[model samples]
Target: MSIVQETPIYRFGDFTLDVTNRELRLGEKRLELNARYFDALALLVREHGRLVAKERFFEEVWADVVVSDSALTQGIKAIRRVLGDDAANPRFIQTVPRHGYRFIAGVSTVARDDTAPLPDGEAAGSPDAASTPATPAAGEAFPSPTRLADRGAAALATALATALAGTLGGAVAGLFGGLLYGFGLAHAPPDPQPGTASILLVLITLSGFLGTMGGFGVGAGIAAAEYAAGGRAAWRIAGAVLGGMLVGGSVKLLGVDAFNLLFGRTPAGITGGMEGAALGLAVGLGAHLGGGFEASPWWRPVAAAAATGAACGVLIVLAGGHLLGGSLDLLARSFAESRLQLDAIGHFFGEVRFGPTTRMVLAAIEGLLFASCVVGALVAARRPRNGLPA
Candidate 1:
């Protein structure tokens, strides 16, 4: 009689590497990896804590398939990126110069029965069953209730984190905008009745409120998209656009109604659904291009987000979409007795009044600040803390 060996399932950090299923999962999320990359990872994991020489990888992982040294390097790099590990400050993997590599993280193992009873359609000893892949069918992937609950909890946590990041970013952007508008109004030719300090506080408060609303909408959409599609670029962009449009349209409609009811007038050319959608599209595209949620060396995603935001801001201005500054200017113009005036601020942009140049410049600044902060905060939120899952 032959004795069958149980398959080993390795658990390290928050990841589970199931040898039997040939799957790698981080928390409840299944990471997508190439077949060879998966094999390379499996090899490193199987020989955890010990050096895996280059020759051994070629022999075992790339057996009968000739490849260059760069292939191994790229595989390792891809692994690091997926694991969110830094080459300079290695966490899960460590290089042993040109000799070999080691899986430095502590790992635990569990045994899975290979001889377990087959499902109804297949017989255990049949040729078809023997040739069948180990991967679970779509419907059978999450067979346990506990797993579904865990995934739900994880998604909720991620949504909240991204929302918070957006709020923080919006607040920062608002603060900067408030400073510019407040100071400009205070120093206007009319002798500054409200005082710089008072104006600054009011403007800052208003800007912060608007920013918070916008940021939350955008951030929540991103989280939802990521959860639903799992790194698909198109899905993420769609989510962003949907989220931004919903929030922007609702806010604009409400704001206009409120003003019309209170003062029998409404501000025109203010930021609305179209503007929000454009910004959202830009942000989503930037994040996707920058390596989307799981990117390592964190700065790449953040910088990309900022750059895209700046460009979008410029486009919004050129397309006659009003951002916070322009919207505020419109609001001030809507009321004859309104104390708020941004005309004096245009002097900085070489204009006699708050002009297109000033609006465009401020919009760019706002976009850069908002995107960088949101992406940066999200990245920080996703980072593992004290060796624990993020």
Candidate 2:
């Protein structure tokens, strides 16, 4: 019998681990994973189905960083979920009471040509000491230790780009909205309080618009990161947006109540909680459905716009009953008693009612914002420099 050394590529069950690309593919679909989890997986595979101790994982994976055993537990759970393995009757990974884990599945080293073309434009340099002898398919090459670092860099870059794109989009929207209201272009306020009215309105409008833009952009950035990490773009977008809204809403509710209790002043309207929950549901559904247009380059933007507009309508109606027939008495009362200086507070409080034209404009703004989010996400998700292995 001849001894075969370890290889960068491994095939076990229906999964293919392209260590070079740092990806785990099931046939054609690529599974999403974090860098740390992948590192732990690669270590286990390298050990050739042998038991990997918890202490060893900490030394290698964590590298002096203090963490609890739960981190490892979570990583194992994530691996199982991706591999569709059950803890009770495990197939791939089996836990040893309190000792460690063992890779029970059979692993085969994939033959490869180290001199083949690298995916990320790296030169097909000489193979290192770890190179194993084998005949791999065309375009397959062994991944170096630097592959993990490169993947991490790519993730960071994507996040930064998404955040920048979102900030720019929000700033533009704020400038436009602020100019319109500041110059007396929009509906005039009910009680224009002297020389400070326009300045106050512009500042307040810019602040609120910027806040909304920032929040949505952060959500979109999260979705963009998810897509960059090989997740389904549509589902990620919807999930990220909905999750962000719900969280933000919850914090807002608690913060408002806390502030009111501390200072004896209401910070939010009565329907604020309802508005957040409802808006979260509506926006999430809209993003989820609009993601279907991803295949069509032209219709994708249109879908995003439509979804945004719909979400906006729902939000407006939920917030203060501006779109449909609903009472705004609570909102009005909150505004009257609250000390907060908000832009167009009268309109929100039902003092300056929104006509059909005003409502349509608001909806259009929402649509534009949604479209901007799509653009931001796509911009960050541009063809990755180091694409998945062929």
Candidate 3:
């Protein structure tokens, strides 16, 4: 003969999971859930707040069986389906990246004695009159991917896109600035010499490298926002763009200020911080708004192009003043040897002249180049895959 007892119940929100009977109920109604899923949910609820590693899931849920990872994923998906939880925006379970899962909701426990029956007037199907239900927290909970490898791949692609954009932005700035410098030289009365041209080429290349770094900061911000806050398309894009601008601007202004403070000299000039902030702001806004598609489009080539172009344009304008200075040593050597015949070089060095007209021209050229390259790359990448919107 065997004696049966009422099981202990674990309560969270409106659901009560009875371990003794292996039943889960909402209010007075019982919900049909698979035993395996129930086991996984029970474990999650038990360890609430702490991440349950995948290895532990196998040991505890599958009893150390060499099961595929898909088993755990299916179990989790089933649990979410029953709970009406969104994996993109979870209300109960949160997936820990590269790890297992965590139960974020609060829980309480109740124990019942089966030996003692209820009072004559009490009903078994009614809500638990003896227990006080803890008030569940307001709003939906965050959800992440059950698979780490998938998210990791997305992260890598986002990172690569940002880096490439930054580098391209820098290259555009340098190339245009060099062109403007050469154009200004061409109109001068004296013909420019080889040494001056070589020096300017090196200076232009250096400018491109620096511009690339500045653009990279904005890219990082966009990626971080997307990964951290999963939201509606508008919210994600807005948040990402805003975050990118803030980060980009901060990178430019603060970096320059730091160098000035440390060196006891302002190498970027009095307006360097202002220039950096402007560049950062433009990059963020252009990149976020350029796509003009849904708030959260599957593809973002247009936006990338716009952002890269915007960043390149701003940097090229700000970097115009650096053209002649960068080539000073080479110019000096050439001048000493009488190898530089251009009177324009002498005037440029003496006056430290960089005109606004030239800067605007450079901006237009660099911006166009950046936009074309980024857009082309994005379109090409998407072409092979079918069903994507044009």
Quote each prediction's TM-score: 0.65, 0.45, 0.40
Clashing pairs counted in every model: 0, 2, 3
Cα lDDT listed for each candidate: 0.71, 0.50, 0.50
Kindly indicate the candidate among 1 and 2 with the higher TM-score: 1
* Candidate 3 weakest lDDT stretch, 10 residues: 134-143
- Candidate 1's C-alpha runs over 4 A off are 1-40, 43-76, 80-143, 184-194, 385-390
Name the better of 1 and 2 by lDDT.
Answer: 1
Query: In candidate 2, what residue range of length 10 has the lowest lDDT sum?
Result: 121-130
Candidate 3 Cα deviation (angstroms), residue 218: 2.6
- Tell me how far the alpha carbon of residue 195 in candidate 3 is from the true structure, in angstroms, after superposition: 1.9
lDDT of 2: 0.50
lDDT (tens digit, per residue) of candidate 3 on 211-250: 4544444444444544454312343345434543554456
Leading candidate by lDDT: 1
Worst 10 residues of 1 by lDDT: 132-141
What residue pairs clash in candidate 1, if any at all?
Answer: none
Ranking by lDDT: 1, 3, 2
1-390, model 2: which lDDT tens digit per residue?
976543457666667677767988887799997676787777666664578888667546654232335457767777888889999998789998777788776665554454233343221112221143334332223434575466456556655554555445445544554554444323456554345555647445643454354445444544453534333344555544554455445655765687578767653343233433333344344444443222223344345545664666555654453311121223334556533233353364354543444544554454354444444343333323212111
